[model samples]
Target: MDKVEVVVAHAERATLRVGDVFLKVDADRTRLDAEVEAMSLAPVPTPRILWRKPTVLALAALAGTTLGRLGGPSTGSPAAWAAAGAAMRKLHDAPLPPRQGRAGRSVVALTAELDAECEALVTNGVLPADLVTRNRRVAEAALRPWTPAFTHGDLQIAHVFLDGDEVTGVIDWSEAGQGDALYDLATFTLGHEEHLDDVLAGYGADIDRDVIQAWWSLRSLLAVRWLAEHGFDPFAPGCEVDVLRSRM
Candidate 1:
């Protein structure tokens, strides 16, 4: 029998990998439902759903390794990065999933949320006050109106899989829904800004650089506390904190 390997564990959920199968256990049924639906609707490659229960989902493993890690450079070639961009464009162009719920926050609501999170960061001293303030101002550019598109919501590099120079699959779709397209681009390139040109080249579209930068700041700021609580050190070298510092 294959041993169960813990992939990740947090208060909200956990994932276990046994052989070629991944079992995702979550308390929130809605998120699981979203994941199932998004995978079905996506135009790009997604993991095969082996089976599903209310509290647990079993998925077949995809080929190849992850595109990159959060705190490290992607060893993938430029073509692989561009392939990921092309895949994202396909996903963005796909039809919206049915019964979309809480697609994303409104501009006013997002700004308010950023403000509250920033205050918490400063009060808790998770990040320096000046860094928090500067990033907060920088994040404002992303608060404007945007045309809704099918989005991965959490399109982190780690979620994308590549086989040599080709994108094989993209996983983790719980947060998928209609949202700003730029948010996906920003999230995918979060800590690895050097690959933006290659990604954009493959995406074959013009993108707002300022909006992408703003999202980089906003996402890092909003995520620090949650990551810390989840036993992830965003302050590690070449990690989220370094992403923020690069802006200064």
Candidate 2:
């Protein structure tokens, strides 16, 4: 029998893998529901849902490996990266989902949330005041209005799978819905800036480079505290902290 592998676990939820199957266990049924709904709505390739219970959703594994991971080097060629970007563009062009996703927060709401999180960062000494302030200023550009699209709310590099230059599947749909398309681009290339050009090449749009960079800073600033509290090391090399310092 294949051993049960723990994919990821935190306060909110956990995922376990048993050979060909993956089990997502979330206490929040709504989140699980949202994930199921988004997977159904997404036009891009997504995992096959084998079954679902109230607290757990079973999924069949995809054939290809992920594009890469945060804080890690990507072995994917430029073509593979570009393929992922093209897939993203296809999803973005699809009809918007019914609900606003994580990337869909209003400017005022996002500003307030980032402000509070920034205060906590400085107050708690999680990040230097200057680092926080500089990034905050840069983050302001992302607070402007954006046309919403169907986004894979958490389009982390790890979520995109590729078989050579073709995209195989995208996993993790809990945060998917209508949101800023730039935010999705920003999140996919957060720690992997070198691949942004390649991704945008395949996305085939007149993207605003500055706005994507702004989202990088804002997203990093917002993630540091939460990641730290959740047993994740945002300060790790090539991670969120490093992304912020690069803006300096």
Candidate 3:
């Protein structure tokens, strides 16, 4: 939305939406060869050799500046942090829609999937199997008291949008689903630790520590697998492989 405003105000502004970028897995030699053998000539998403790239790059740079001003650790001023904290608290407290009640998903089932993905990562040399298993067990213990609520599956800094000191919008709805609310909060805290305590505190008894930690660990582990499966790239824009690596 903010980008739309900037473009409208300018004499002319180029723009490139995220769908233009190909998923890393899709672009790999193996996948391309598979496509050729299948003899499918379906159109594939590709970067446009036009002003779109430059426009997207400019927008990204501006978005980074906004994030730094609002969420970065460098401000070092209590008032700024407090204001940002208040905004985050408001977001956490907002009334979310009821969970969609999807079938074939449960705490145990999801946890098992997370475990298998962790094992895959270890096999690929990105993580240690033993350590991941230990963490997986800890997460399972935490899920014992699980309760479902609306969750934004991807709530990192990249998914949040701010206008001045206020949150303007949130992007990426692919992972949104019914789950422990703490999962959403944990994802929110990944890169923006400065806002964690205040935001979670605002959530009150809606979620608890164990659930939050479990979500954090599981989400981090899932992130690693996602990168590996997608050939160390995000299917969507905004999140990069390095960010997922840091979480792992």
Best lDDT among the predictions, by candidate number: 2
Candidate 2 Cα outliers beyond 4 Å, as residue runs: none
Candidate 3 overall lDDT versus native = 0.45
- TM-scores for all candidates? 0.97, 0.99, 0.55
Give the distance in Å from residue 54's predicted Cα in candidate 1 to where it truly belongs: 0.4
lDDT of 1 by residue, 80-158 (tens): 8899999999988888766443436688888898999999999997889999999998999999998888998999899
Q: Best by TM-score, which number?
A: 2
lDDT of 2 by residue, 1-248 (tens): 99999999999999999999999999899999999999999888899999999999999999889877999987789999999999999999999999899999999999999999999999998899999999999999999989999998899999988888889899999998889999999999999999999999999999999999999999999999889888999999999999999999
- Residue 96 displacement in candidate 2 (angstroms): 0.8
Q: Candidate 3 on 157-244: residue-level lDDT in tens?
A: 5555455544444433334444555565666665455555655554444446665666556666677555545344432332322233
RMSD of 3: 12.0
lDDT of 3 at 87: 44
Cα lDDT of all candidates, in order? 0.90, 0.94, 0.45
Better of 1 and 2 by TM-score: 2
> How far out, in Å, is residue 41 in model 3?
38
